[model samples]
Every structure is written in structure tokens, then in C-alpha cells.
Target: MKKCISFLTVCLLMAKLTTAQIIPSFEFGVKGGMNLSRFSHTATFATENRAGYLGGIYARAGGLGFNFQPELYITSKSVTVNSGSTQNKATFTSIDLPLLLGTKIGAFGVGGRFYTGPLVSFAINKDQNVGDALGNALHLNYKDQNLAWTFGAGLDLKKVSIDFRYEYGLTKQPYNNGNDETRINLFNLTLGYRLFSL
Candidate 1:
């Protein structure tokens, strides 16, 4: 009976150690960034890219090799369009959510990371000033929801992180009474600081 109890205790301890080793560290942080965006298809309208900004919070789970990150942010995007003698500007504000999977390579509080993810955006507001002729001709309307794919690389030094990412639109916005569609692409740079880790 004594031998059986001793063996069981040892087994339990080993299991606990194994479980601890498998779990990864967790981190929470805040981030903000600037972005440049343009419409993919301008058609008759000449489109010019415009600068935008975003600010958000993020959480990361994992260690040295593989990590999962999820983020929530508010972003503003804009573009200027010119058709013949008419010129107009459009701006969109939205809430963005991104779910990313990443791989890290480095040690001793410094690392390089590569990540890819899907992002979903919900539009909070859309503002555009169009000429009467342009509005009637294009039948322009803004979408309430949008989707995209994000690919990026980043560097982490101690508690600070910097990233450069490109977002490709996976969905299209319809216009011209649904006869035409357009997609938007964006490039952004972000800076982040770790708030806490466990």
C-alpha cells in the first residue's frame, strides 16, 4: 500500500510539470499606427491615395515559436478621386478586428515575427462629397461591412514592437447601381508597447 501511494504521487508531479511546460505565456498591449490607402480600380476616376490612422488594443498568447494574436482597433481611411474636371474626396471610419497567427525567431528579449491573418471591418461612418452629375452617374454607396487579409512582419525589442503590414481587400464595394465594384488596399506601420505579461 505504501509503495502504491509513493508511485501515484510521483506520477502526479510529472504530469503537472509536463502541463506547465506545454502552456505558453500571455501578453496584453496597446498599439497605434498610420496607413495609406487607395482604391484598386478607379475606372474613369483617377484615385489618389490618402493617409489615415488607427489605434487599438491587442492580446498575444504563445512563446518563442508560434503565437496567436487578436486585436481590436478604430481606423480612418480616405481617398481623393478625380474625373475629368470634377474632383471629390471620400472618407470612411470603421472598427477593425484581426485574428493572426505568427512565428517568431530570436531570443533574449529580441525577435523577428511574421504573421498573416483575416480582418473584418465594420463601418461607423462614410463621408463623401460628390458632384450632382457624378452622384447620379455612379450611383455610389458605401458598404457597412468589409473583409480583408493582412500580411505583416514585425520586430520586437524588450517591451516595444514595430510592424509593417499590407492589407488586401477580399470583398468589393458595389457602385453604379451595382453594375461596378471596387476594392481598396492599404499599407500601414504600427508601434506597440506591452502592458503586462503572464
Candidate 2:
């Protein structure tokens, strides 16, 4: 675990330095938004959209023709179960770092982002004892660390930007039901600003 973290840190620093040397245009920004996520299991189960938050600092380099952007941020995500009007929620927090390859054509810009080389997380809290939500005690088991995948696109304007991305869960939801893996897939749309380097 220590080795992995160290390696990732080195890689990120190298990428930043390399991008600075090769590209001329650079922008730093802050972004925040909601994540609409759904949890799906092999059998029928209930799930709901829980409120989530994401904030990060990003560096955009290179010129109008082609560019590379990378962001480091922390995100909050959760999945809820609702049955017959009763609901239960499980929330997890993670730190994510993503790198994007982007291009421009006319007024519209498009890009593909590769997210999740590593994620560190911990369980903040959960609701299992709420009656009717489960009617009885429910057992949950999960690990604190996970690796996830995110793929998506965005629209870039001169002063503002809008981004859309989808995240997929790769680790099994730590639970005793071996066949059941907590599946969460979310689409994120964010509003951002170019805080530095116009």
C-alpha cells in the first residue's frame, strides 16, 4: 500500500512537469456538483439517488489543437435502498485523481478521461437498524479501499466549462452475500471556472 501511494505520487508529479515542458497554454480551475448514482444487484433490489459532492484542482496545458488536463479531488458517494416507502442509505468517501486527453474542433470540444488508478476510502456512516427499511437486521461487510473506473466527456467554453462523466464500481461491495456486489454507476455533470491562466 505504501509503495503504491508513493509510485502514484511520483507519476503524477512527472506528468505535471512533462506537460509544463511540452504545452504552452495552461489553466487551473475549481469544480463542484452532484452525482446521481444507482445501485444494481444480480437480483431485484431498491436503490435511490443520494446527494454527493466533488471538488478539485485541475491543470490544462497545451494549445488549441490538442491538450492534456489532469485533476486531483475528493468525492462523496452513496447508495440507498428504498422499499415500500422505507429507505436505507450507505455512504462512502474517496479521494480520486483523473487524467484527460482532450481536443478542440470549432466551438465544441470533446475529451476522454481515464479515472481511478487508486482510491482510498473509509465508511463515514450507515443506516441498517431503521425498521421497515429492512424489517429486520441486515448484515453488511465492506473494505475501506477500492479501485473505480470513470469514462466521459465535456463541453469547453472560453470562460466556463461543463463536464459529463460516468463511474463504474470495480470492487465488490464488502458484504457476506458472496454473490452480491454493490454496484454503483453514476453520471456526473459539473460547472467549472478557469480560476487561473485565462
Highest-scoring model, TM-score: 1
Candidate 2 TM-score over all chains jointly: 0.61
Q: Which 10-residue window of candidate 2 scores lowest in summed lDDT?
A: 132-141
Error of 2 at 49 (Å): 2.5
Off by over 4 Å in 1: 1-23, 126-144, 174-180
Residue 45 C-alpha lDDT in model 1? 69
RMSD of each: 10.5, 14.4
| TM-score result, candidate 1 | 0.76
- Look at candidate 1 and give me any clashing residue pairs: none
